[model samples]
Target chain A: MEYVIHLAILICIYLILAQAFNLNFGIGYQFNLAHVASYSIGAYTTALLSTELEQGFIVCIIASTLLSALFAVLLGGIATRLKADYFAIGTLAFSFVVSALLINWKSLTRGVLGITGIPRPIIFGRELNENLDFLILIFAFVLLVQVFLYFIFRSPYARSLKAQAEFEHAAMSLAKNAGLVRNLSFLIASGLAGLAGSFFAYYINYIDPSSFSLTEMIFVLTIIVVGKPGSFWGVIAGTVFLVLLPEPLRFIDIPPSILGHMRQLLYALILFSVVWFNKANLFPVQRGV
Target chain B: MSLDILPQLLINSLIAGSIYALASSGLALTYGLLKILNFAHGHLMMVGVYMFFMFNDWFGYEVIGSAIGCIAVIAFIAYLSLKIFVLPFTRYSYVLSFVTTLALSTIFEAWISMQFGVNVKSLTTGFQVHSIEFMGIFITPIQIIIILSSIALLGCLAFFIHYTPYGRRLRAFSQNEYAAQGIGVSKTNTSYVVFIVGALLAAYAGVMVGYETNMQPTMGNAYTIKAFAAMVLGGLGNVWGTVAGSYLLGLVENLSIGLDFWGYSIPAGYKDAFAFMIILFVLLLRPQGLFNSKSRAA
Candidate 1:
């Protein structure tokens, strides 16, 4: 029962992450690899304040979201100077900067030891200390965020974003500000990613540098890419498929040491094969006029 | 701050520069030709180190023979990776290229972590701890090996790119897309060659670095970023520029590692922050490159 509830909470957490990525990369065509930086910001903020300062969950989550958005705006401002592929590299550099701080700032971040013993949230003077209660809280937030995203992504603003994504010049010729739209998308995506990060910290009761690595960012990237970009339903389906993909392997007789590697190997193979087989549709080339 | 420290810093700087030079040169070639950031290049380097370890450490093969075997394995992996991960999506969208490389990176890193665990591993070079003194300067065997081999390899690369027909084709490909194709440069085959050569250089450096310091799965990310910074410092398209940039990075890094500031010394762990600041300065001041001109094709 506990396992099932835990899985549900995890799915909700990752659902938010995947959607956030979809909004930026899929819709805005902005490749911000520092999404994980925002994630770490949220996790570290929540973990530190709740453990050290005894702050409640609501304050921490709100603080995490706002701070991550602030970071994204700053990163986006500098990154806007770059072209398409260079923007990805720029964000990756920013991500490295964040991770470097997390590793080297021992006095503040505790370095690699990570922060533990995170406290459960007490809302409305009620102590919601159970896993089931956490699951309920996480699901409510996911549902609320999803609805908000659904409406925004389907609006005309998203069309302008797509215009900026596919051809910034054409959009700019029509008086649309590509830079502003990109920054807005970045803020929204990173802010939501931060919320998911806070929920993750609350659920696990711990936060570490390892959790916000390139691998974790790739996992979220894989979810949205494999799910089909720019489609909310596709991302939702992808999240469910991926989060549950490893569940059935518990009954297999593989060695404990190699099992994790094998799963990753399989995931890589699948991702490779899927892209290869569907190359015609996934990547339509633009021939010269 | 003192004359004694100058000799040690120069030696350390050269050693560090050699590794970065190897990596940055590879990055310069690929970025110049393909114009895509191969994010998995670092992970591919990790695979090479592990392959060397499997041969020399686990199977007890001779060190020289193991290095050859490791290069062969990495070349084969590089070939397959290009066909599967790069060729399909590179023409379509930048995001696809980034995603594919990232996916492959995750696979490589995960496999390394699962197989090796979190414990650090060091390559046993079987060298003495005592430094050899020459002309009042001390140098270790590993440092000597690093400097000599890198020079030989880089010299060979320079000769190949400047003289050989295949190298000419690579240069043609780098200068302009349509012009290269117009001049009968085979895009697919040349790209495969580019990927293999780039990865080979990075792997060679990675194996040496693994011998020098601790080897872990996550080491790839830091090296990749540093190599990129070096690539920018030297120039994007020119290989020799990468050489200069790598040494520049090495010198600046070691110089800043424990610098004295008005009778106070800085911490070594802040070296990465220092490296990042150098990157920022390069990007802001000389975004084209410090060593090479902007219009360079190779």
Candidate 2:
């Protein structure tokens, strides 16, 4: 039961991540690799605030989400001014910079040692320490985020954003500020990533630089692309498929070292095959006006 | 630092820069012709180095011969992979090709790790002397070879691109593939040839690097980033600019290392930070890069 709850919690975390990524890639058509960096910033912020300042869980989560959103604003300002590919490159550089800071800012981040012993959430005079309770909290948060995202996806704002993605000049002619829409989408997406990061830190009870590498970013990207971005259900389905698909490999009689490698292999193969087969419809090319 | 130390550092930087130039030029070529970022380019080099090592160990082939043979084998495999898997999807979205190549990179890395454990292996055939003196300054022979080979390769590549019929066709195709096809250029054949040539150049760099340093599967990550940096710095599709960018990057890195303010020595890990900082600054200041003046911003 504990294992099942743990898996459930992880699914909720990944759902948040995938949906946030979908917002940028699917709605804004921006391929930002720095999403993981924003996620890391949130994790570290919560870790530091709770461990150092003795802040409560709720305050730390809010602070983490805000900090991530602030960083996203800075990145979005630069990214929205450039071409799509340049945005990707710029975000990749931002990720490296964040990773470097996380590794080198030993006085603050404790370098590679990471932070530990983060306490679980406490709500209304009740401590949600048990796996079942924690699972409920996570699922509620995920459902809330999903509903919020669904509303945003259905709104006229989302329509305009999608319009900007399809043709920025056309959208502009229609009295839409495409750059502003992109910036808003990116900020929201990164804020959600931060929220997910806080939950991840609280659940894992440990946060490290290794947990937020380019490899992790690529995995999230794989999920977004595999699930066929732009649809809320598509992202949810993608999260479920990716998280659950690698579970059965645990029972295989392979060396532990090779087991980890096999998972990566399978992910790579699936990502490759999906992209190849769904090249046209999946991630339709957005023309710039 | 003394003058002698500065010269030595310069030589080392040149050698490192040369490797970046060689690998990045190939990447630029493919990007120019295909408009697809070949994420597997670094892995092509990784596989090539492993093949070179295997040929030397198993067949007892001479060092230079095995290097050439490794390049041929890698180029052939890459060509076949492109023909069989990539060519059929030429008309497809660029992102599909990008994802496919990235997956191929992961697959190659995994297969190599599966075949040979993640232990770093050193090549024994290259020059490994500590240092050699030249004009009151000390440098390694390998450094000299690196600089000379880079210059020679750049000159040859320029001539090939400018003077040959195939090269003119490639240039035309790079400009507009559809138009080139209308003019009777076979896009399939052109793409295959360009990819193979690019792979060969990457293989050559891999073998040379193996000779200079220890070979490992994870080295591809660093090389991949450096190549991308060089490509961006020089501007995509410009070979001369890439070569120039590599040397510029190398020099800046060496100068940073030589910088000692108030007797505090910056660790070598800061090299990546410095390179990336420069890349970010360049992106902000001049997105078109140093060589390409036309802004590609949409």
Question: How far off is residue A110 in model 1, in Å?
Answer: 0.9
Task: List model 1 lDDT by residue over A1-289, tens digit each.
Answer: 9988988888999999889989998788778889989999988988888988899878999998998899998888777656665567668778888888998899999999898988888877877789998888888999999999999899988888888777778888988898898889899999998899898888898888988887677778778768887899999999989888877787898778777666676677666666666666653333332
| TM-score of chain B, candidates 1 onward in order | 0.94, 0.92
Q: Candidate 2 — which residues are off by over 4 angstroms?
A: A124-128, A286-289, B1-4, B58-60, B84-90, B126-128, B135-138, B176-178, B261-265, B295-298
- Model 2, B1-298: lDDT tens digits are 4454776677778888888888888888877787776667888888888899888977889887887778778978898768655665557655566567767888878877777777999677544487777776776666667778878877888887889877788899777778998989877777787788777777778878887778998777667667777877888667678778888888887778776657776766567776677677778788778888785642
**Model 1 chain A poorest 10 in a row by lDDT:** A280-289
Docking class of 2: medium
What is each predicted model's overall lDDT from 0 to 1? 0.82, 0.81
After superposition on all CA atoms, what RMSD does each candidate show versus the true structure? Answer: 2.5, 2.4
Cα displacement (angstroms), candidate 1, residue A243, comes to 1.0
The collision pairs in model 2 are none
Instruction: Give the per-residue lDDT of model 2 (tens digit) for A1-289.
Output: 7877888898999999889989888777787879999999999998888888878878988999999999999988777787755676678778888888888878888889999988877878687789788888889889899999999999999999999887788999999988899999999999999999999998888998989986677678789888887988887988888998988888878888787668778888888788777877876766633
